[model samples]
Target: MKEILPRQIESLMNILGTIPGIGAKTAERISFHIITSKDNMVQKLIDVLYDIKENIKICSECGMISDTDPCHICLSPERNREILCVVEKPTDVITIEKTGEYNGLYHVLWGVISPLEGIGPSDINISKLIERIRNLGIKEVFFALDPDSEGETTMAFIASKLRDIEGLNITTIARGIPLGGNIEYSDMYTLSRAIRFRTRLNDNL
Candidate 1:
């Protein structure tokens, strides 16, 4: 059958709809706007879309996205190297950073242990974390993972695995974040309070 709308327009809308927050109607609107926009704007978008893959890379030290080996935070002398904050995703690091409550180094796990999903420690960046803790003089480690089963498991796994480290304090953020909620979706105030009131993992949980 012949298509009612232009084939190219339909194709553009289909692709746009694949983006996480964009729905069908929003994708349609975006496609129309992009088509009507200045060629320079479209070309600029295209350039960056292509450039991100080449320019962006995972930080070798912290597993965060960066153009440098040890991201800016890891390299910065201003941050407290004695404490390390471990989070599930790179976005969580941003969420916690916005709170301004933590002034320490960060380690992005990149993922969690989801058994049904077949994702285990080997799949995530846990080995890198151990190496960092061993090499760096981090006195305390904070777990800022989500409240789901996967998050709990991941946090426990890390803590137990690092038990051999001497003089290390492993703790977790308080229950300010509701169950089933992730750090990325939490508000600034709640996240800040959680960080401020953090406690040892085994003591409270």
Candidate 2:
């Protein structure tokens, strides 16, 4: 392979380095690979990137990425409209759907409440969620947030807001240590199930 000029390589590295988790070294490696690879593969990648940028959009109701406004899941009649699952991100919605245990609609919050980061309820799609609850006549809301501090704080805030609404059953996923055995590296599923199965929050003895 011919030697890559410093200025050209540096320009490519700067662009790729802007992506999260990609540092200068990794960016240079990727840039070199892309430049040295076959022209057809690179063109295909370019085409796909343009296609995604031009066609993709967020689902109007759930905030999931889709080419359509309502998205396939939202339009599907097979889903249970009475039950709505609340998730932190669109990717989380996809993950839960892969489990195949749930057959309900979803509401993606887009993010959680993190006061330390200056991200509050208003920053996310909370108002749209409230409107959905009131207009759609949903029967139950399942909170499927992450098993972290921000997740808990967001859940509590949402629960309090929904308390006054009548005939709504709000529930969180169950929680446990995790499947891996070590108490340290528990996945979200185990932790979620543990919380779901938690005893009364106010256990006074």
Which model scores highest in lDDT?
A: 1
| lDDT (10s digit) by residue, model 1, range 1-205 | 2178799889988898999999989998998788888776678888998899788888889989888887999999999999999988889988899999999999998899999999999999999998899899789999998878998899888888887877889888886899898788888999999999998875443
Question: Candidate 2: lDDT over CA atoms?
Answer: 0.76
TM-score of each: 0.91, 0.81
Each model's backbone clash number:
0, 11
Alpha carbon lDDT at 83, candidate 1:
94
Q: Identify the runs in model 2 with alpha carbons over 4 angstroms from their true place.
A: 1-9, 177-205
How big is the positional error of residue 205 in model 1, measured in Å on the Cα after superposition? 8.1
Candidate 2 per-residue lDDT over residues 21-57, each given as its tens digit: 8987899899888888877657887899999999999
Give the CA lDDT, 0 to 100, for residue 36 in model 1. Answer: 88
